[model samples]
Target: MTIPPIVRQVVVGASASDAYAAWTRQIGTWWPLQRHSVYKQDTSVAFVDDQIVETSSTGETATWGTVISAEPPSSLTFTWHPGHGAERASTVTVDFVPIGADRTLVRLTHTGWEVFAEPLDAREEYRGGWVGVLANLRAALPPSSGGAEDVWLILEAAPGLAATGSVFAHPLFAEHLVFIDKLKADGVLVAAGPLPDEPGHGQTIIRVPASEAAGYIDAAHDDPAVAGDLLVLRVRPWHVMVPGV
Candidate 1:
């Protein structure tokens, strides 16, 4: 069928802005690259929200797409490519819309496969590809804020302490939960939860004010669960916070 030469459609989903940013900015952290990657060797993953890269040693690089249209917490559109050596390329667009309380609609479609020299092969390559990647992406976007900004953490240990920090196994989820519990107790954290869904890795955020961030980091290191990699966190300052303003 030559893969119909194109894929076109819409996606709607509801999610927090932070969740959206996690998807675009930290894609490599979540994308199932090991299995779906097209590169033959030297597989590498890099993401800048505007771009998602999976490069191989044989020079067959796969660029997922670009952020052509993006509305934080609502929708995004980008193109897709299986390999740098491919004879053709395609586009993929995704949208997130709110359908209910703390819920979102995610619509997606990929188009322009006819441009590829091997339309059928390209189509075949992507038959269930979209399902897999999109499913991963969808799961990453959370239904609510979970008060990531207001969170604080303390760590006494980090599991599987490594020399190069390659393996990330540790009490990450448990630590964050403990941190959230502390915040809740202090009335600093409005809500909190694990984001292993969006980032496909252990991650969390707080919904506290900007001025309170310094102490939050300090207190995080004091925790008994996440102290080992205290130097790993790269804290950033947000301009402001609004629920729907």
Candidate 2:
């Protein structure tokens, strides 16, 4: 028996044209090099010779799939065979719908699981895999007009501060807010707030170009709280599935 398709969606703060271009043209930049690829060390991924291919530094090539549909700025559908050959291929359909002038909803549906020898296993793997993949795509694309984009970063309180529930009372807390405000003024920060349920934990969503994300992260780590050991910092890239009103 076959299983249902794996469907995932994210709201990218970019024009449909920009989102589609990043997804197709500049996929290598944000795709997790360590986690998702046919080879342990993949040099790059690109659309070449009618197939989406992953090439390794050693010059070995792995064909991901054959392109069946290529509609720019709207939809793309392709056969997917990451580990196997064309004989054991599945189908993936991605739709880019413009929800606003500067926002596009990217929906991905992976179907044809029966093509794999172990359909359930493949489905399970891809279920988690697509999450990271979309996050990478989100980071790769540029922000939309109005200076807004969706990117993920990490926040960690100093070890003892979190356990003692005293992060908010720390002397550097006010200075931390000032630092965050500076980032917002620079159009790099979108929203940031403490996690009520998780004491001493917080998260910040920022809008910046992918190339500059590392610099922004370094700046965030220099926050007085983090730098002074009142808080610890951890950063990871993320995609926003829905935008707040």
Candidate 3:
């Protein structure tokens, strides 16, 4: 007897792009690795180089799956075989649908149960597991604060503990780059770079819902460079009288 795939859906309080980014790039921050990971303790998980990899604090690593397809703010499909080999892999697909200005419906479908020795039992176990997983994901996203007005913010960053020339070589720089990637994934990053002739002066531009500006500012504060004192950031609203005209 063939077993049907598991399907689950949840509504998240975020735009489609933000919801997708949280499910993908920000997964490590929300996934309950303490109980669900291969090591089950001090483990971190992420999608890196087209594979879902889990790493233990002690340097041990496990491959959960290989990404099959990824369309930002729409759908993502990947193989699944945590703590097992590729021969026993299944498939998981997640779709994001916008339902409102600040809301998205996320659907997850798990399939390929026929590959398991006991497809029925496996499906039952995962059906229950996905509930907790999706719940955790939904809770991690910001709550809906409906507003259509947008505001552009400029971030002026100056060197702190790290010298201007050495800032790029600092370990915190890697984390900063990851933060920038998250911004881009969330469709908020407009542009970022240093001034053409002004040494040690850099700026970043982001557009976000006016009411949620505080949340984005808090996110920027969490950036490694800012949090680690490698860089100091000052955010201010930008009035675009003539944008790219």
Candidate 4:
């Protein structure tokens, strides 16, 4: 008997090109590292040497899949073999279809279930798994905007840490700047600068869809500086009264 492909789709508020890049190049940012890997203790996942490998905190790694096709801003197909060898692998294909200038429809199709020993059970497991994975992907995407309203996130140092002295002198300060530059390049950050006089306070204005406001906030908190306890963040929704052309 032939098995039907398991499929999932979601509308993301990002350009097709940006969406594709996030799905392929920046997967580690959005993927649920703890929940969707072969190893329960995995720390990170990456596309290395044409394979999707999950690495644990202790540096052990497992192959999730192998890349088969890569067409930027459009589609990608790869072998799937999480917790199993290539002999029992399946195929996963993701397509990015542009619906508007700032909107794209992302569709995921997982097929070849017959390769698995327990095809029915494996198929069911992935059905639920893909749902969560897609949700995380949606949240990780930079908020989509339509030139109407704008939102921004603010970061500040923890209470006592702010008084320590020049935050710019901190070792991670340079890395923090690099992270900010990355956000800027992704077109999510509008402007960011340190409030030198304020000691521990800084600001960043971003353009993201309101639906994804919470995710954007979470992303800010995930910043290396914030996650490393080098800084604390407070996010607020801001509206631009007069946006520059």
Candidate 5:
């Protein structure tokens, strides 16, 4: 009774290096710790000093796994055990394969289910869990694009007077949403989200020809939150770069 390894794959809209960096370096910013963590509280997880560590707001830390081997922009292998001890650790390997100049097919393989008391049940559980984990990864990375040739703009929004906890209830919040909706309707919006680590900060990506990007910047300033000083926003040019660049 040998259990097959659980394999999951997702295509990201970034170069191999960018995808690898997001998965390894920026994991703490995208991982859904609220739904999948050893602790019930909203903790942050990151790869630190060759180990995957999770830290809570109270400063308590948990060692989830150790890095076995890492090849930047290529593959990473690590042990997997969050709430469990090293004796129960499994093995997870992630491979980043470039499908194009700016697209990568990331494949994650989880093995060693035999270590569990009920290997079949554990495998089934992780099968569903990995789907959500990968979905987060997909959302974290930039959306798929043509290649390095494509141009994208990042609209960075930082809290101003609305930095407090009641930002959602702020009167200008509704107008801010309308601004976002207009971008979507114009078909320039790519993706948008609040920063996980930075409270009251957000970013939205829009695809635009380089020639027209300047015009979009002026349009984005019309956002009610920005105009009202509730939020500050700035546009930055972004493009996929090769590994060396």
Candidate 6:
């Protein structure tokens, strides 16, 4: 079979808001420039300034694109034309769809490929280009809390820590209450809660930086529930949600 000159509708995962951010706000942070340009030495696909239209060695290259359709986390379309100055260039459309918790579906499509001679070549090149470009998008997503931050630890725990748990009735568990409350106040505790079970055995996630995690972990050892040998096996990790720790 012959590959068509134009490739249409490339999709990937992300949120509606993030989808918009990916192209408008977050484009430069992730779009890989190493794979683009007539000489593969251009810097136009994406960059830091968020306003870097296109740049070449002297004056041999130029990029033209404006986001025509943008709904954020849903769809984004733009016109792409660079260097060589063909009579015409292709139009690219990208969409970001929500898949599930913390995931987005990203799709990309390019039209006007017929404007180029070897449409098959264009498709093949884009197949690989999309691979790298999308990979860059995956890397650009922000950490939890709807933005980037330091270490984020997602925690899960049982009911003994809840206000209505079996042990919660025991006033002697004051230490647990004291420490839990303090962590919550310090902002080091991203989130916490008793289990959702009737008996209240649930989990909580805490997002904090390594520099601040020690304080919380150290204090956890003092909880009456922990000290009393009731709560066991608290798993811990200094997590990196955005990589490049």
TM-scores, all models, native as reference: 0.45, 0.58, 0.59, 0.58, 0.59, 0.46
Q: For residues 1-245, what per-residue lDDT tens digits would candidate 4 score against the true structure?
A: 65656655665779889999888778888999788886766488888878988888898888989999998889999999888888878999998876434756677878898898888788778867887898888877644544343444343344222225556777666767887887788788878886767756687777765555545555665566655445655443444567684
Error in Å for residue 92 of model 5: 0.2
RMSD of each: 15.6, 11.4, 18.7, 16.5, 15.6, 17.8
Error of 3 at 192 (Å): 51
Q: Which portions of model 2 miss their true places by more than 4 Å?
A: 142-245
On residues 103-203, what C-alpha lDDT tens digit does candidate 3 reach at each position?
66677878899888988678778866876888788789755666677768777776653544567787887888898889899998999887767656588
- Summed backbone clashes in each candidate are 35, 1, 0, 0, 0, 25
Q: What range of 10 consecutive residues in model 6 has the weakest lDDT sum?
A: 2-11
lDDT for position 112 in model 3: 96
* lDDT of each residue in 88-128, candidate 1, tens digit only: 54677655543323433344555676787776566556645
Assess candidate 3 and give its lDDT. 0.78
Best lDDT among the predictions, by candidate number: 3
User: Could you tell me which 10 consecutive residues in candidate 1 have the lowest summed lDDT?
Assistant: 154-163
**Which residue pairs does candidate 3 place in steric collision?**
none
Q: What overall lDDT goes with each candidate model?
A: 0.49, 0.70, 0.78, 0.71, 0.76, 0.51
- Candidate 2 per-residue C-alpha lDDT over 1-245 given as tens digits, one digit per residue, 9 for 90 to 100: 32556655665767788888777887777778679788867478887856888999998999989889889989999999886889999999888866434666677878898887788788778877987888777666543445333344433343222234478887788878998899789877777888888867787767665444545654765677765545655443456567574
Q: Point out the higher-scoring one by TM-score: 1 or 2.
A: 2
Candidate 2 colliding pairs: 158-231
| lDDT tens digits, residue span 1-245, model 6 | 32222222212234567666767765645767665554456454443232225555565435555556656557767666655453666777776544334544455666676766876566557655665666566556632333233445443344322234465565645666676677788766656666545453444456654344433443554556654434421433433546532
lDDT of 5 at 124: 74
Instruction: Estimate, for each residue in 78-97, the C-alpha lDDT of model 5 and write its tens digit.
Output: 99999989999999999887
Candidate 6 stretches with Cα past 4 Å from truth are 1-14, 38-52, 56-61, 84-86, 142-245
Which model, 1 or 4, shows the larger lDDT? 4
